[model samples]
Target: MSKRVLLPEDPRWMPFCKRYAGNIERFAIEVVGITPSYQQMELFGSVSPSRSRTSVASGHGTGKTAGIAVIVLWHQLCYPMSVTLLTANDMDQLKATVWKEIGISHERIRRGRHGWIAEHLEILADASCRIKGFEAIWFTESKTANEKTANKMAGRHGEWLLVIADEASTLPDAVLTTLSGALTEQHNRMLLTSQFTRNAGFFYRTQNELSIENGGEWNNLRFSSFDSPFVSDSSLKELWDQYDDDERNVRLLGISPQDSSKHMMNRKVAEAMYRRGRIIKDNENYGWLVLVDIASGEGLRDKSACILARVIGYGDMGPDARRVEMVKVPLLTNKIRSNTFAGYVSDNGAELSNVTYVIDSGGLGINVCQDLEDMNKVVHRVNWGNPCFKNINKDRYLNLRAQAMHQAARAAKDGRLSILTGDYRNQMLDQSARIPKTFTDKGRIRVPPKGATEWDGMGSPDLWDAVCFAFLEDVSYIVSGEIGMGGLVNSAADTALKRTEEMFSDV
Candidate 1:
């Protein structure tokens, strides 16, 4: 019988042995037959014996899980009996994704005739057993992952130990504390990575606040979908079309979404809330509602526009959501009379009976509202002269215009409103956002008549206010199937508040 020799014949036979242990990307390509793109290689380059801790913030589908799997195998096989602890925000995440990748590496290496595959790795322990989390020959798993898993960082010695915390956003500062103490070993490694979902906490601090460039602890690297060769251009475009600029930037470019200071109805929210299809389905469906902002003056003075919107969804979908949507917007013009406006709305997109009309009762809308009501076309008047707030927040708004606009802004901030993408979309967003507000003598928020002047060609944010009228006035019809007029909504306080809430509801 031939004796089993642990050593290989030549350098070419086992290239992994020739490569440095920290070269994770090389091991992935050479041994596992998996090639990482240039960006992935940069991530591997950041890993080294000298760099004890490394934190990576990455966008979606940048092969983070695959890279993680490669590193685990390389750390365990090359370092020889070194324990690699894997953890995440949740155990399901670890098991379904990171652990699955680990299993894939084990299977790939075994099939590829690599010496690393010669070793057997069975579950040495699990939560079902005496141990709380899973543990194998060169691995440990914990997802309750708080102080209990932090305790595992100690007592193990003999080989270089590596602690890999996946989705480090939720991994407590306690784990870092444990890692700090366990670094007594000369070759210990700690790797933390996650999608940049949060701009606070230890992950944020490690990645942004205290970076290696600033001579801080941990080598930090950020990878976007654009950086990864795995994501194709077509897929990138699809993502861009699907999400708002801020969301797409964060998801595809590894950029922070935004700080707190932004318009209530910013571009980020408009793009995000927008859906592909124009159709509204389900029981919540309300036929198109037309909102008319009457020109403050006749002929080229106050630009008049009518917005057609529908309730695609109803109620507070989340802590931050808007159930209303603007479907179509007609061109702006000067001095559209109530008769012409009524005829324009009925003929533009929706039929007379099938549609609901909410006309701004402020400005020079009294005649327009009276004309639309005379036409017997389900006209609901929105009195902007009333408090900007409604229901619970009535006291906080100077007038209904301010209330409607500010409410719409909150929806934008929370990613609750959706408007179709079009040339008018930009104009509408610009108008909605540009309306400056201030606290009145009575401590009420007031969006004054600033933009409807000669400076901006008397641009009254007509379409924007029309859109607001849809939410403040038309949405009540969607919820209760009723028509209302004057200052207050015709429905109960909860009904009006249900359509939209106060900006500072808690306050």
Candidate 2:
């Protein structure tokens, strides 16, 4: 096959090529032969003289790869002797995702009636393509970026240059710096496509620096999975159920996670738990555990809380088998004595017959635990200030409270626990989501003590602490030493121990 350089004098395809040169949407439809989504249409239109830079924060299954391929082909076909360069965080992504899509689109164009345009475009062995006679000057090249190979993106000066950075969020700063330097020419264009996962990065900064609304240089856009023609409702629902809100925003909404690096749990997990809590019917098969967090005094800033959780698979075969279904009806009051609080717990437990009470026995909690004990209730007086249980990861936690909070977070993440819903659900969820996660000097994960945490305008995290107390009790039954991972509450070992104790008492 002879290399044919397309000239203005070439009457066969020159007229068709010149017609769609400025119109990418028409070029994509007529030349490329594919229908573009509304978001993709906007992406094609964003390529103008005024906007040399375009950054798209795209969610999953939104046809971002196709959009990139179209722009590459459009640039190659429309402009004579033009260059398009594509790069990603790594070589595998460059070849596997972006270049793979380019190949698919190229094949599609060839199969269509517009086989002439495809004929001049020759895909090379090195993951690149070139126009038949203009092979040296007109071509698109892909490179995997790292500290060493990042410089390959630099010095790309031409009349029409398009540099695309795929998966831009995680791409190294060195690659961005080098590629950005190439956009010095007037006709040169830069395209960044990613989920924009992190708060601080070159991609994140470009979004701010190139804001069109604020009268910046770049045209920025977001493509959500909800708006994508490629994604199904069932798939979206699965994503909603599996990920927390911050992660959901990144993966489904094409929105960057706000404070995702700091928080313990996001609202999506809390809301999902609440939704599941509504559907799953409660039964009498499981024993209940009453988690109590007592306040110092009955004041505006001080309030005690009690959460009754139905323990499923408590004495189950393994830790993973256990689940905690929290009853939406929680007892919260700013005005209640320790004795009165104990009575309230006793009444709630009386119907269940087999119940265990876990009271936070720091400060005024001791008095409440004693009152519950005096009422002949099975009680575990847990001091939040005490060291975490031996079986729990002591190296990871600063204290029992930190251990409990981390455990509750893990349970929420693993779908092992249900969150509260109703009147106080907002405040409770807020507190749970705002639980401070920090690392100690020993590089172990730790949650700050209640006193050290900032509660903003809200009072003590009593409701959240009460929930943590529930998970704390899940492991508190290890007094006999080294029990297997038979989950919280009604394990076979626990039932056997209780029967033995009762038999000894009867004797």
- Over 4 Å off in model 1, which ranges? 1-22, 115-119, 123-137, 152-158, 261-507
lDDT (tens digit, per residue) of candidate 1 on 341-410: 6667656634322567787677667777777677776778887766533353464466667666766766
TM-score of each: 0.53, 0.57
* Tens digit of per-residue lDDT, candidate 2, span 1-507: 975456433565677766877888988887778999998998888874423788888777899888898889888887778898888756665677777888888988898887767877888768899987777898999877666877766867788899888878777788887888767777888898888556657777777865777687667888899999899999888667644455467777887767654567778777777766532232224556788888877478778888776655531214434567677445777787776777887777665535788888887888788988888888988777777656424654667776677667767877777854475887777788777665332223466655674334446788888887766634432122212212433445666787799989967
| Shift of residue 427 alpha carbon in model 1, Å | 26
- Whole-model lDDT values for every prediction: 0.61, 0.72
List the RMSD of every prediction in angstroms: 17.6, 13.5
Where's the lowest-lDDT run of ten residues in candidate 1? 127-136
Q: After superposition, how far is residue 91 of candidate 2 from its true place, in Å?
A: 1.7
User: For all candidates, what are the clash counts?
Assistant: 7, 3
